[model samples]
Target: MVGIWGFIPHHRVLEEDTILQQQQEFEHSIHKSGSESDVVESIDENTEKNDKEILISKRISSDNEKEHENENNLEVEIQDFDVDYDYVPYKFGEKTYKIREIRDEANRPWWKVFDEFEYRNTKSEAKSYKWYKWFPEGTSSAEKKLLVKLDIFLAFYSFVGYWVKYVDSANLNNAYVSGMKENLGMKGNDLINTQTVFTVGQIVFEIPWIFLLPRIPITYGLTIAELFWAAFTIGTYRVKTVSALQAIRFFVGASEAAYFPCIHFLLGSWYLPHEVGRRGALFYIGQFLGVLTSGLLQSATFKNLSGNGGLEGWRWMFIVDGGISFGVALLAFICIPGTPAKCYSLFLTDDEIRLARRRMKKNGTDVNQSTKALFDLPTWKKAFSTWHVYFLGFINILGFNSNNTSSGSFVLWLKSLKKYDTVMINNLSTVPPALGILYVLIICVGADITRKRFLFVSLSFLLNFIGNTILAVWDVSYGAKWFAFCFGYWSWSQSSVFNPLISDFFRKDTDVRAVAWMAIYIIGLQSSAWIGRLIWPTTASPRFHVGFSTCAAFSIGFAVFIGIAYFFYKNDERRESLENGIYLYNSETGDIPQFVLDHPEFVEKNRYD
Candidate 1:
């Protein structure tokens, strides 16, 4: 019978070290048995060796085989790092091949064999082996650089796409103030209703898009979605009726739904958990820049092109913005790397892909498996069961209340500023958010470097409370003006760090449904509009104390909620029970299992673990 020694060279080195240690421990056994010489004598006689030469020859052959197997096994291990398997190896017909780790005999350790090569027959074994192979042979140092380049390229592509994203939305507000309703014979809060419809469409599709994103190939899907939204944006410029305008905006919102969530998921796939928030900020900054650029573009184009081609300057704004979106969409198709596994078409090679995959896997995340089902029973329970989900949703609702209003009413508010022209107001209005984006980047970078999130987010909300409070209380005599400007800066700054917190708690690519999350935020935010229209009343503008008071209330509520969550979550981390829905901590020792307190059923059965 063949000895069950290590088969592959690389495997042998690891096993060699293990076996050598085991041999040392068992050395006395070999000497005590007095059978070592007898076994050596048997092998020598069977192989026609002289009695005196038996011991040294056998020892040298065994060592040589072990060394050879070690090198071969190392190569296999490196290649299999990203490929999932449940097997070890065995010998057959002069070749070493992998086999499933499952045992043919009871009481044997399963997973000792590699799962890929598991099979009772040669055909099944061959089929299993196919999955481990990748295109582009052998890993090299050059492949590492290529993967790094791909990461950089993705960053730049995301930046450009993010810049294009909010331009269309910003143009909506710009056009609303620049005679869109009048020119199209629109009336009522039809614009609000249109935005509502657009948001509804977005909510309906966001989750679906995020679920389908990985299967669809982000490079293709995102590029097409961008182009589709661009077409609808330009379509907005062509429409002449309220119904038509509403229809166009609804389509634009629907097409844009999957984008933000998919981008978040994509970034997560490429980055580590701690690394994600800052990259998230980079993409977000592009969005802030887009909003800022829209204002600057509107200021520059509104007058000179007022009647160019018989279309108003606002129409040209839509047209130009759409053109940019289309251009960037095409660029992304060529540049973006979908995932490390299939990134070979770009600069990355097989070895680099493995390295990137290994680094991500070290964080306990399965980087490439289709996470579409993460919303399924157990996982969703794990996610939504946590208080983090509710608090995050509430925090976002607060953000939405501010954002939706700022998106819709800000231009109208700026119309009342008196000192700036329509063009100047548009241009100046974009600055606070642009500056705010800068603050967010700085804060996020610092947060990431420090490996902390709650403090930054809490401090950010506090600043927002102060800024919005100033906006509410000081409405006249440049006090409100300065307040508005400062509020905008602080408001934008908060956004950069706050957005990534959603991903922080969720902590997986599959948990990312940006469109769905946004939809949830919008749904919650709609209440703000409902309450705002009644309490503050549209007529209460310039000094809407009620609106300000409501925002302040929510802001304070968020601070308290976040503080409580941080405490519980931090405790949960210490106990390693964060995964099982235990939020509160032990009072006396601070070491009590939340499962025992909250989930008494689990304790009664004594199976909480």
Candidate 2:
């Protein structure tokens, strides 16, 4: 007794009346037609047959009238109800979806909508474009819990691992300036040579380590590398010649080379593009803290432990830093899980593991592929052929070079001042990197909110250019020169942003992502080895005008490269959209056609801006 207007009680009573009226009309028509067929005896038999025929017609007419009334009611209801004009219904196969309409207001330039403050306050709208879609509205409570666990377990280790790596590497500089030079009879540029040899080791082992990354569990690999490097760091205390120290440093660099790229790759495997930026920044913050701690440790050890147990203060620094590294290595073995699909952490439940795998797959991760393919020639070709590889690689090189100027020149300048004691010099050196930590944290949070990687990177280069320009002049007041030197560390913020940006660019290709990350470190380290020594030579001392000027020019070049890379990224996006038949009226809202969503490879390319 339900009408098409949806279960109307009054319509059920009215329907019975309308059915009876239709039946009466049908009987009248039938009787009128049969009146001409009447004869005496024939009419008697025909009357009985006519009665049966009228009953049949009455039932048929009643059913027909009810069906017609239902159709009319449905039509009236549909026409009267309000529907959302902003959403268009699309049907594909057995499924239906409501696609938000693309509006004209969403077509504004990226720069216009690139404010972090505004993006934080604004809620995402249905018909508008979002700069980042990693954390869309309607994310379940389960997903929020998973992200928190990931930050606690996976992100925490990455932070500690990076911290230990930087502290170990920087110990050489601290040791050399403290007492290693006097103890080991090291001469001009010998310290630089040791660092250069270490960089060479990193370049040599880069490819081999990347190949090994996928074949072995990342946690095991990281732990083994950490243990070996820790041993080599302990060996540094026994070095009697520059060659001995150089040999130890080389192995240290080789073992540590895998740590950075593998950590970045692991982060990408677990987190979405939007989430990876902040995590990557946190990892770099570890490096800043390590640098800061090394300075303070060096200052304290020089004062308190300089002659304890017949060991030089520099030797004790090596022993203590190495011991801490070994302890962290043991902790990493316990805490770090490899990847979502392969995670063996005791902290996770079965349901959480399944949820993690499903979420990563939805985000376009291919967990089934072999990590060993990182060395395949075709995979290498695919990675190298991309324009992003060259442009981003060059940007990393410039960034590392700029960072080296801060590490080398600032300490040398402090040493040349001769006003502060060794302890003050070491303690004072921590200030710039401390400022760098703040800069990196703020910029990375903004980048995540605004989804503006290239913009922040450009700004980092500008800061470097300005800071270096002031240092190159070298004629300003002491306070002015000091401020300029400290400002240069702001360039380090680019480190936190670049890795996540590259990961986002190559998200669909795991092997390519691994190779690209390796290339970044290899090129950066190798370039820094040669370029760092030339820019901050022993002869230059307090004011390396030539080196600072060269770095300033490189900073401008880095900014230009970033612009070109962004242009190419947009071009690729547009070309892919056209080839895939994804028509877009504006930058914001658009129909995500079923065909594109069904294809696994096209999912990220279509959805990500």
Candidate 3:
């Protein structure tokens, strides 16, 4: 039991500061650092086609005086972090951004001699915050070129991949309400049971991928996962009983379990902290559209294709959804840009690859983790030892449960009325997720513009709690209930903010980041499996008193826990700054290398900082 619970320590939790001094300090610093933090963008997408539109990288000069004298390389003048010339802001006309250059030659095997990253400096942000400038401020031409390719290949892939998967998931809900329950003779709690089985399968299968990813090639891992999801999704069309539906759902869930967190890690591996926000937002857009598309698809199919091939509309939905999933899987084979260090994309150049690595290093992102460390007992120990794992994992559970409305509660309510056709019901069910797009945009855009991540996140949860509270009242007016349903959907999507926030928080340890990402869905989903079966059985849907009450409590938990986590994160950053004069990014992760996955180096690895 001690071994099992070792990750949780008494010191991990923070007392709500009566004075809230830590909160004050963090908010103050974020304005300065976060403005320039994860928000940088790629240079002009069109102008850099020939790569001539770049700020040329000069060769490292043997004489510091001569390098500074060069006219093309503007002499940088900044007030922070630059001691011994290592942390210097670079000049671009009248505007300059904090740029740090670090050189460690002992183990530097790459072509670039020094790693130069653009530091998130608020000093320049005051002047640089333009309402209209599209590119990241003070970006190098080479860096811009890389961001364009990454946006094209990886960002779009992130959007499309989640879009197809969610479309299928929402299809499951639509099918269940449309005709599958009647066809399969699904009785009390059967809908919840099917969902529970999928959660169980996901939890069971997620463990291996969490451990195996860094130890295997990216292609092999993606192929296995996609094959499973595609086959099981297609198989669902043939299920004759609830048991068969549950069985297929389980395998489909298990196969695709690693996707959400893995993509998050992939994004964090390649992009800066500021870039992550909008990219993460784009990723969630796919999900919203997926849910929305599922409804529209069901409506059209029921009207057009039902009974055409001795198949119900729900069955047809599965066949079409599965085909889409398979097609997206093929796209993944080509477009999945492996980690920045080991990127094997056909769109990137050698210089752009190096630029990607430096950008990550600027914000202390670890882009060079060794696969050889996978087996080290200390590596596993470092991953588990941090408060980050427990704090972040549990916070995600609370966040997800807070948002989970079982059996598509809105759909269930519409179904209960017995007044709407399949077409109207499907269309009505989409309102919450559709409005959610705007809600998410408001929150994410606020966080990006103000550089206050925790502020928006806490506000998101507070509103989530309010929405669930209204639903629990259940005796309210009809229009009010509709308002509650729509209100909840608008506030419920915080995973986008949380994804990059968690990535930025746990940036140092790659294993811990991966594990925390895994915990978000793995452990969170496991708890959900039990909750769905017992507390939220469809028999009680549309007015699940216990479930709604539970959601309300967890929503508050989400707020409290996130606040506590933020306090500690800032506290750590504060202490490190005080001790070292400035926070030093000890991050070391690399792009995916060929041999790291197949035959890891057995070199003795350093313990996690």
Candidate 4:
């Protein structure tokens, strides 16, 4: 028989003499007959004696076998460790297996196995951390330096790209309410039509982006997308008709669609599981900051630059914002690192690149790729069939809906007040986005610390429920409504953590991860745009009771979906443990399971420490 660890199973065969002795004892007992009770007693005593003797002999034999096996294993282990080779022998059950060419030892939680290899020459001391526990563990000095460099070069550009994408998309709304509606003779529903068509464009291009992203380098893809969107944003400055503005918006949306998911996918490729959430949060925060900055920029332009240089304030907003985006696109082309394995950034050294690749490999991430795999039908089928994609997509729809209540309608509410001018309306709109930035940072940091992403996601939904309830049911005062609007933005924090959640769940499969990540936004944004058009119709005005009520209900549903996802995830983990003959525990103090010690890819997913 083959053992579980893929080695020949050891078997002990009984000697012929031992078998004959047992048969003779049984025959003797059967033949002994005296008085009935006496015979029975005699047979019982002989039977007991035979059984005891057999047990004693078996115990002795087992001890001898174990002792011999241990001696052999020890010798093998010593020999394997003494050699400077890629493969190491590991003993499990009655078998020994060879582990080959480990790329990274430090990132694996079971690194102690390698450390204990007696003849290993490398420095294998446990890394010490001076920072908080939330920070990524087992990071070497080289990795720390690399992380700083990646943050400065890669993360910064991702943030900027995301920021500009949002600024360009959001400028339309700011422009519409400020003066674009009047300038282009856009009546009721024209503004909403623009949003709907933009979302349509986004949906149309989502799958194409997903297909192409893996084949092309992310930096080049993102830079090209950014430049295209910037040109469209600049084109918005020349729109003299509603049809022209709609055309410009649609193309802009299509170009900007790649930025979010692509950036997220890039981050997942570069960072460890523990390191991704905070960076993702920072990347997401850029969107809110962009929204906030957009309002401020519009206010400034309206106050100072309106009708100056032969352009209206709204037109000037696009021209200036597009110019800024063009500049960022240029910078991104120069600065953005494609991936840690194939990084072209001036900031990273060859050693750092190797270290980064090693870390990702240990995490079981696919660091290498081929263009042919991009169109693999089986890959897409598996990715689409998983519950992770559909459930997360549904949850994201709710999240998008909840956030839109703040971003879409809150400024409109300010406009409806009539007491505030365009400047005040633009300036006041910044409040929710600013608060959203802080909320996102706090939640994301907490998620990283606790490693409870779904928990935070639930809390965000609950906050949305509360915020929406106030907006839907309460009409006591403007102060209460404004507070509700600001509170509603807190749900935007969910976006920050969602990427990390997806990254962790799909960490083992690159194609699935890429497809699922993009699909979530595609489904969520399209659903929100369509559903939002119905609930927040032109008739609803400032107090869209129907929209708020629907959002509050979805918030509850979102929480329920999160709970369901958690249940399934736990069940899946347990099933994996059972199939592998490994016991699952909530702590990390017991014997390291052979499965984990052998498979570096499962270390992070299985580690409870």
**Structural similarity to truth (TM-score) of each candidate:** 0.67, 0.75, 0.75, 0.75
Model 4 C-alpha lDDT per residue in residues 332-439, reported as the tens digit of each score: 876776765345455555445545665676555666443334576766787888788788888888777865543368878878778989988888888988998888
Candidates ranked by TM-score: 3, 2, 4, 1
Model 3 per-residue lDDT tens digits across residues 1-609: 112334221111112221233333334444435542221222244444334212211112222333233312322231121232333443435855333322111343452211111123322333454434545566555556677888888889888988888887888789988888899999988888888888888889878766765545564467568867887888899999988888889898888776876788788888765567677777888888788889999998888989979999889888888888888888787777677645555556544554565566655566654344444455566767878767887887776677654457889888889999889999888888888788877777666655567778888888878877888888899888888787675445677777888777767656666666665556676777776566677888778877777777888898898888876776666443312223222325544433223322211123111
Tell me how candidate 2 scores on lDDT: 0.69
Global lDDT of each candidate: 0.57, 0.69, 0.66, 0.69
Better of 3 and 4 by lDDT: 4
Name the better of 1 and 4 by TM-score.
Answer: 4
- RMSD per prediction, one decimal? 17.6, 20.2, 17.7, 18.6
> What residue runs in model 1 are displaced by over 4 Å at the alpha carbon?
1-151, 186-188, 341-345, 371-378, 492-499, 508-542, 577-609
What is the full ranking by lDDT, best candidate first? Answer: 4, 2, 3, 1
Q: So what's the TM-score on candidate 4?
A: 0.75
What overall lDDT, based on C-alpha atoms, would model 3 receive against the true structure? 0.66
lDDT per residue for candidate 2 within 1-609, as digits (tens), equals 223533211111233334554454444444445553342224356457667566556777777676455535432222111122233444545856443322222435566433322211122332232445545565566667777887897788888988888788777877777878888998887877788889877778777865765556777777788899889888888888889999989998888877887788788888865677788778888888888888899888899998999999989888888899899888777667677645646565444554565565544465433433335776678888877778788887887787643346788788787888878888887898788788887777667766677788788888888888888888999998888887777777777677777776776667677777777667777888788778767666777887888878888888888888877776665444322123334335775545445443322232223
User: Any idea how many clashes model 4 has?
Assistant: 0
Give the lowest summed-lDDT range of ten residues in model 3: 9-18
Q: Which stretches of candidate 3 lie over 4 Å from their true place?
A: 1-85, 88-134, 490-492, 578-609
RMSD of 1: 17.6
